[model samples]
Target: MPSKGVRVFTYIAVAGCSIELSVPKQTVVRNELNTFWNGDLEVDARNIDSLFNKKGRFSFKVLSNGRLVTEQWIDVNAITGNASGGTMDTIASTPSVFSPNNDNIIVTYGFYEAGQGHDVLPNQHQCYIAVAPNYANWQGKLAPPGSAQEGKPFNRLVLPSAHDVGMNSMQSSDSVLKKVGGAIATSLVGSHEAVAQITDSVSGPAISLVAPNIIFSLAITQKDSLDAMLQIGARYFEFRPAHCHKTILAAQALPDRLYFQHSAIPGMAYDQFLSDAVAFLLAHPAEIIVVQLRWDGVPAECARPSDQEQREYLDAALKQAQGQIVAGGLDDLRSSTIAQLRRNKKRLIMLVSVDSLSTYTDAGNATLNGDSIVAAFPKVLTAANERGKAFINIQCQATAANITEAVVYSVLDAGTTTSCIMATKAICDSKTLPWCRDNVLRTCDNNVLVVMMNDFIDGATADVAVQLSKQRLEQ
Candidate 1:
């Protein structure tokens, strides 16, 4: 548990739990792509038994500037200070073979404990250890949709949208089970008495890693802040609302109201995002905004609302955002002209699901109990401009690999074909991103749009906003 201590450097990874160690020439970051950080150890082990002699469990602290980045707990009887794996090591995200000391060296990171030994990895959680690379900033922000695109019937214009817009900061209280599960596993670190607690928590994805723990979904999605997205030329906001948290028994949701979530996992508050959008739209009157609401992560009871209930609930929420959206429901909006909507100052538009059932609202501190039926799937659709309601079409359902690649380091740094930009190009070149491009130039002509976009952080998505806003479908 003791050596020259790991040197630190800049590091990045997709994770629900994150902690970094910084030293002059080396840096080590412990992050989970599909798991939570126990957040137990942040600093190196102190080689002192008293430091870890807690309730008969041996735990060590990993701190950054004296702040607890994370901790590690082990059975008190396992190590004998005599066990040592000796080899020089470098701190990086890529995997490396090194032994700090056999008795108690942190080997595997970002995984649930192996049944027989900690050295073995659990299939459910895997962390990519590599030399941390520096990523570049985005080229530039896109221009907002204006002048050249106005008079065209709303459907005649292509819309660029973001998918799963709220998957940031999962380790915070923002997510229901993520919080409880994280605390349960983290609190008992080094506590041999509570091994069962760790077992229960890491067993499921919701509590441990949101189950299914697909390779791409290991970390929260949507890297940009709300302000950053607004500044990035995103006129359309794609979100799924869910309950914030739920009770362990009966599985009932907590009353945190509606929150932006990627399925059962919560992100930000729906109202807070709405307020920010309203403020932005108010500041930019000429810009038309669309809020596409879908049901991918709603609770069981709310997922299938009877006929009028879902529609009514949405109508009520939209009505409350009076200044943000146009008056009346789809029936009233089915045929409005862009020129008319623009003139009326109807800048904010709602794009609710084709069916009601409250699409996303589960219990617990504003959960959006919905699903991630993927908004990236492609489909061919003819324009139906005169349909009246000013709305959009989102083609959800994407392959797990495609979605996974979008959230990795490839999204920001240049890498192989698996990077985000490459995945985006594959989709953009497909029938998806350009579904309406063939005819977006014609205003009021035939106004049906199957608008969809890829997941977040950087790459083609940002350009997508710029590309559509400029009416240049040159993918």
Candidate 2:
């Protein structure tokens, strides 16, 4: 591994692995997009980013563990070697070509384009390699949801309502995945405005590239350094349509840098860390805070409770929060919880984002049913109707009501779309199911929401908070 500068070709002979270096004259270096660079190695400094007229050629044959490896080459001038660095070799007055460093490092060489003559393409030409430290042994798993298969995971999300009625809705609306003509892929870097047009046409869960690899590498060690890279293609490159890393930072009023960990329990003093976070948020009331919670206690084999038991637990939690409460046990929530939630509901409204009637969890938990879930949703609406308190369903089921795009992303991101659909479909299709009557998809009043519970963890919570904060500020 070398820095992004010029270096002398060297050979380190490993017993089973070996590499050879040489310069062959009249070689062409190009970029991924078939752009030309340094057609002829003419040494000139004017086109620093372009290939120079460096005459001479360099090539290598690498062998790993007695296996014939791929070969690479570099065309250079009668090179006077300046200090060479990581993946580059500098010629005093010629185009510099890089020889292969490792068998694991893959370099795809192509032509770098010049307006009329050969030029050096600094960005795409040199160091255009994705170096996976242990990629030799690494295997790619199927992406959940977004892919073209079932059971095999894909990178896209799924919603029950979306499957049931969303297609019909989409039939009349524009599609975000627009088809491009064969003539365009080569000639244009599709207009940024045209990309915006597609994004604007479709309104749903938007994806964004979450974090930077360079920053992560500097912060965490080798063990977790590759975690983010593995997530690159599987995850969406960005979040919301208009949102970028900068816009998010500005809204949060956070420092320029932030860090995350998979867990903090057992390794760190949990209670003290939580207390410090709480204190900081309390101290800086204006600053939006993000927190991660992990459980460290020994796992308990608690049996899944009945609807009555679940409702009882929920009611207690709501009461502790000093809000209106509800308890719907295997029936309409209005019959079980709405009346209770309606008491003084205006100030501290209580809403739950539980899977009411799901027959399965996203991971294929087989106990949830869709009709049962729908039965529970109306309690919030009932409470909102009786008292002015807002009772948002906050469930991600599109067929239910008030669902948000964040929930859509979560189900897709988690690779649980099939399970979610199976669970909801059981209820929606069941003739005996109470809420399933004529209810393949339920239309929702704007205020009654089906918010995505998973959105909160993936930074989608910040978007909701920002929207709410903006509305409140305007008011």
Candidate 3:
């Protein structure tokens, strides 16, 4: 965090997300960053009013040996141009020049030159920074700009959703396992296991290959709760509903209602998380959230059930989730327009996946399910490009053999930051997304949405979801 250029949000000003900056003994920090944020450093800590005063594009550059190595951009207005949803910390003010208190900026920066190879990595001390919401405290309802995006057809907005919003924890205490004939062998863990299972994605009951404690550190996508994600500007959540609490033999059983999960491990009850979203919407009124759901993680014994059995299994799960979500009073956006939805103060929009379930779609209460996300995204991009508007899912992360967190993470770790950024830019390019491509992509009169996973830097990665959302919302 640059002392002068960085805009500290929480009042009584703390450094923006504890960063580690490597300063040289002879280097003059002031002279270097003097040109970073325009020409002047106008930051205020004593005055909460001006805490969010800077409105525009801001970038952070790492200068090592007088050369730029890595850079970060901060977009403050991604929430609102007026900064309605921000507040200062509750602590008293001790202002300074940089920040009134001038808590020294800590940044983890690179020390190598541009061309220097894999000689150095990010930092030995691995920590992620997520700024807590200030001025913007919890109202009854959380606000995501998606709610106020009126007149935009479904899927035609820049909405980035979390891959597995509730994997915030991985507890066998909450396991939803079953003895499916083809569940990935708990022994066959890793990318290979993930591959073997996807060969029969719908056959086996979802199982957790690894144990509880290990998975938590490996798979959990959220560091905070749903409300936290909303404050960070995330409008979309991707969930997998399961007959949770399925323990290993000693007489296993399923929970009454569907629960949240990555695959086998569970975290947060489905109804409770939805209830929180409902409360937030009731309070904010203007903000809405879009939830994409699928009936997932059913474990069955070695036998593959008949087609009828599979349909029954899926329909049952879908109905269960529908009942719970309906109980919570969220709107079924399948038939409502942005206008109709807002008029009713029904802000939670849901997209349920029921492969080939014509019975449900024909009933007209909701829409059909989604396809392989990887497959679904391309069509969405093509459509967004053709119509100059889009409702798309960006499936960028690679999941291994049996959908375990380890394999998923292995793939992501293998990707370089440069590759991830380039891949994001390619899909978001005007050639695909419905945005005009200049130096930076911008949405036009038509609507545009770019939902990503794995590398959903904008509000998907738990570490900096809030910060990323601020930058991605505008793109």
Candidate 4:
């Protein structure tokens, strides 16, 4: 089915059985992987049994017009099992498996036995092979010294960022209840739920108890740790830190604590986030990370830490990362290049809200005020088209209906809540990435600086950022 004079060959070996498949090249799209095969590959019972019985490894090689493109071997255990058929989205896989030599060619295979009643192949084995962009160590590859990107302003480059970077941890109902008192927690839940649902005494008590936890579930944006995010090419991170109530801290016998929160539900400790990030920076000397800290607003029932207290906490936490922190005004940071920053061993940019400006200054770190940045959803891109100002355009595709489904399903079956959220996030991310590529990045004109993604930021978002950054550099 390929065009004239173009041919693609896939040789797959499972256990002792080997099959060679030849596919002709159709139109190849940039930054989009081509799914060449989706049907079943007949495998004998003995080979199929060997696939599951032993820890067999499958190897595949892709060739285009008699020239080898990419080859990889994967363990049988690594292939995830899904009754609904495996994903064809190549970006969902780990970045390390991607072919470093060729970004356009990737081969993924999913094995299914004959007895399994899967819809795709009820009585035969199923394998899927797709071609996608390779994005291993993309940040280092894009901004090395003397590269075209080296001369560009740091803010002007298209960077991948994670929205609410600290919300990766799971929050329990007990933890949420303790952070904000029962009365306030109930109020927060009531505001988000239907009046009728909250009034029912039987379901009401259970719902009230799990309300804050459910809210936190919906608000969780990233699933990967800070170091994993950096390795996946996330250069920017947004953290919303809120002061913990002294009463709660004292009750728990904890010292002055600051926790990253989505609204009022707390996730990871602020100090822990700093330690992980600093450790990553020290290991990867050429990498750069921009951190923006803002106060996640809380209800009037909650008390905020005094400015002096916040300053002391921030100063102590930032001191751990002092060696990597970039010490310069906004103007200076905007003019510096990736190579220039790497040369000075100043790879971290700390941006604080206006109220926290004094905190940054008192810590002896040159920082940018919140005014220097604009955080907007995709709908506000037109209004955020101002030049010389940094913009974090969040690529969020989850709809109200999707969120409602997650909440209702979570309430019905608490066990399925995490999987439901993950599935919803996958669907949303699948849509968001393509939309970002066609609409946001394609129409970008130097106004957008960072493209942020929600709900488990992955290498796919980083791939888009790399593509856009490379395009800009070539231009």
The lDDT values for all models are: 0.36, 0.23, 0.34, 0.46
Q: Which stretches of candidate 4 lie over 4 Å from their true place?
A: 1-137, 171-190, 194-205, 208-216, 245-247, 253-255, 301-314, 317-324, 327-329, 354-379, 397-406, 414-420
- Give the winner by lDDT: 4
lDDT (Cα, tens digit) per residue for candidate 4, span 210-251: 554455445555555666666656777767666544444555
Lowest-sum lDDT 10-residue window in model 3: 88-97
Residue 143 lDDT, candidate 4, scale 0-100:
70
The TM-score of candidate 1 is 0.46
The digit string of per-residue lDDT tens for model 1 on 212-318 reads 12212322444455555554445556777655434422333234456664434456666667767766665555556667676653555333334464455555545
lDDT of 1 at 232: 43
If scored against the real structure, what TM-score would every candidate get?
0.46, 0.20, 0.46, 0.62
RMSD of each: 15.2, 26.0, 15.3, 11.4
lDDT of predicted model 1 = 0.36
Cα displacement (Å) at residue 363, model 3: 36
Candidate 1: which stretches are off by over 4 Å?
1-149, 171-179, 182-219, 248-255, 301-334, 355-398, 401-446, 457-459, 465-475
Candidate 2, residues 72-127, lDDT tens digits: the string is 44433332311122222311111112224444432211111111111111211121
Q: Which ranges in model 2 have alpha carbons more than 4 Å from their true place? A: 1-269, 287-452, 472-475
Q: What is the lDDT of residue 13 in candidate 4?
A: 18
- Best-to-worst order by TM-score is 4, 1, 3, 2
Name the TM-score of candidate 2. Answer: 0.20
